[model samples]
Target: MKYPIIIVTTILLLSSAVNAQKRSAPDWVLETKEAAWQSRDSQGEANEGNFGDVWYSKDGLDWTELKSDVIWSKRHEQSAFVFKDKIWIAGGAAEPDYKLDSEVWSLKIPKRWFRDN
Candidate 1:
């Protein structure tokens, strides 16, 4: 009956999860908190999506919002994660008419998280 179908579905889902993990290696788990932070800019975004931010997951369950230090005021020019423990953002439309640039900017985090490098 319907009860049997429900039990079967639950078993299949649980088995699939166990099998998937059987193929992966284990690493440091962060168990991060959930948060949302802003990224880049939206002044020149398409319709409304003006920025790109990232949600960090340590245990693949909770997420943390990683934020940037600046907002881009122009169009097209992407940003990316460029280093360990931080992000690098650059390349956006500025004044002087649709120009391209190689200028890169690295945003700073709190001094406590800064390691000797």
Candidate 2:
């Protein structure tokens, strides 16, 4: 099956009510190795310092975690794009050492999963 090319964009405008407070982007990674680093510190291992949680938002205002601990290694600064009915993540720095990642990961998204707006 074929799917249309979908482009996602987000824009945030601050209003007076939110101007006094600090807010992170809605798509920010909520989980990472650092969240558990303190307890695992004594294990004699450096924090992998990446995130494996997958998330999706239809409206971009509300996001839900789609999966936790995906097949790909935890990474940041990865490039994410939709190609051939699949979402692909490629080439990000894996944490702890901040070394470059060469692996590519992708997940197929069914057309039925999307609704016409």
Candidate 3:
């Protein structure tokens, strides 16, 4: 009886010490959430004429979407990047006559629009 009690107590103490050590250490595992985006290719099938919208996330969890507004003119294979406090979406393909096109576009985000941050 006493022996069993001692063994259980020892096991519990060991587990508690291990848990404490883990809590003190930095957490290495990442927690990710499922976020939905208004992917233009929302599916991989490509049919023209602006079929989607803008969506974004912070934690990659909760999402906010921009309604159907022409964020850009018709495009495909567009490469989007942020530079000079502006987003540049350039070099894409266009339909109604699939042709390779190069374009430089800038967004009008207020304050220091031309400065690179």
Candidate 4:
């Protein structure tokens, strides 16, 4: 009985030490609550029309910003999906009276991109 207690106590101490070593600086995560601009009108209040910034993460918790201020027009509430082995963005509105975007954009991610990352 004494040997079992000692073993359990030792295990607990080692576990605590391991957990302490794991503690590190917090990670930065981006969340999209609303669009870019802030305006008084109903259109402005709506969560639409964010700038062109792309972020990617293999694990959802940790994210990396791939690019910022992309060439594409900044918009929000857009349709994003994976089709034809490519990612597509379509039909979103921009700021200033929430103008609509008729254009569609598709990105063909190279096969090597996934393997190299």
Candidate 5:
């Protein structure tokens, strides 16, 4: 009984320590949010344009921007999901015209995205 209690206590301590090491959000995220909110408040409209920049975060707070040579057209309202160890993005409206897109794109883990042609 005592050995089991010690093992459980050790596991809990290690879990807490690991979780505490998580990185917090980068400054750019807060700045971007504040700027967008201010713009919407002043202009009475929110811009829905897409910039085609991709960012990924291991933790929900901290983000890292990814640069790739492959070009994807600017889009919004996209549906993304992970399936079979690949991230798939599909069914979004293109920017500037808001035309509906039926195409799909997939990115293998730690790899650049490729259009599903």
Candidate 6:
């Protein structure tokens, strides 16, 4: 009697809390693909070229393109990480050559990227 009532109340409270904690999905989706590229040594084609664009989110719901002028080239399978308050991207392959790049590029976060377009 009393035990059943307490159990029902606890279940209702837990369900309400779960419903309130639901989160909305991000605004932008990165659609990247490994494009086909001709190999240099005639070992067949290598699917290493990256075909996609970069996007940025201002509020997790509103997104915008990062602009093509800023990016050096389109690449995939690159290593990107944050260090010393900057975002670093390095060592990615592009089309035509598909050669592994040895260059490092960095963008200072917030200060460099948060400006109005």
Please identify model 1 stretches exceeding 4 Å from their true place. Answer: 1-37, 40-75, 110-117
Report the C-alpha lDDT of model 4 over 21-103, residue by residue, as the tens digit. 43221111222221111111122335632445444433232333344233346555556655665556666665555677765
lDDT of each: 0.36, 0.40, 0.38, 0.39, 0.47, 0.40
Query: Hey, what RMSD does candidate 3 come out at?
Result: 18.6
Instruction: Write one digit per residue (lDDT tens) for candidate 3, span 39-67.
Output: 24212345524332344333332334444
Q: Please tell me which model should have the higher TM-score, number 1 or number 2.
A: 2
| Predicted structure 2: clash tally | 0
> Arrange candidates by TM-score, highest first: which order?
5, 2, 6, 4, 3, 1
**Candidate 2 vs 5: which has more lDDT:** 5
| Candidate 2 deviant stretches above 4 angstroms | 1-23, 26-49, 110-117
TM-score of each: 0.34, 0.49, 0.46, 0.47, 0.56, 0.48
Worst 10 residues of 1 by lDDT: 23-32
Lowest lDDT 10-residue stretch of candidate 5: 33-42
Q: How many residue pairs clash in each candidate?
A: 0, 0, 1, 0, 0, 0
Off by over 4 Å in 3: 1-42, 46-52, 68-70, 108-117
Superior candidate under lDDT, 3 versus 4? 4
Model 2, 1-117: lDDT tens per residue? Answer: 211112221222132234213223322322221110000011123452444555444433333446433355555666665556566666666655668867776655521122112
Between candidates 1 and 3, name the one with more favorable lDDT: 3
Of models 1 and 5, which has the larger TM-score?
5
Off by over 4 Å in 6: 1-49, 111-117
Between candidates 2 and 6, the TM-score winner: 2
- Top model number, TM-score: 5
- Candidate 6 residue 86 Cα shift, in angstroms, is 0.8
Per-residue alpha-carbon lDDT of candidate 6 for residues 2-44, written as tens digits (9 for 90 to 100): 2232333233234344422331221112221211111011122
Alpha carbon deviation, residue 75, candidate 2 (Å) = 1.7
**For model 5, how does the per-residue alpha-carbon lDDT over 67-114 read when each residue is reduced to its tens digit?**
678846766566666677666767666666768889897766555889
Worst 10 residues of 6 by lDDT: 32-41
* TM-score computed on alpha carbons, candidate 6: 0.48
Best by lDDT: 5
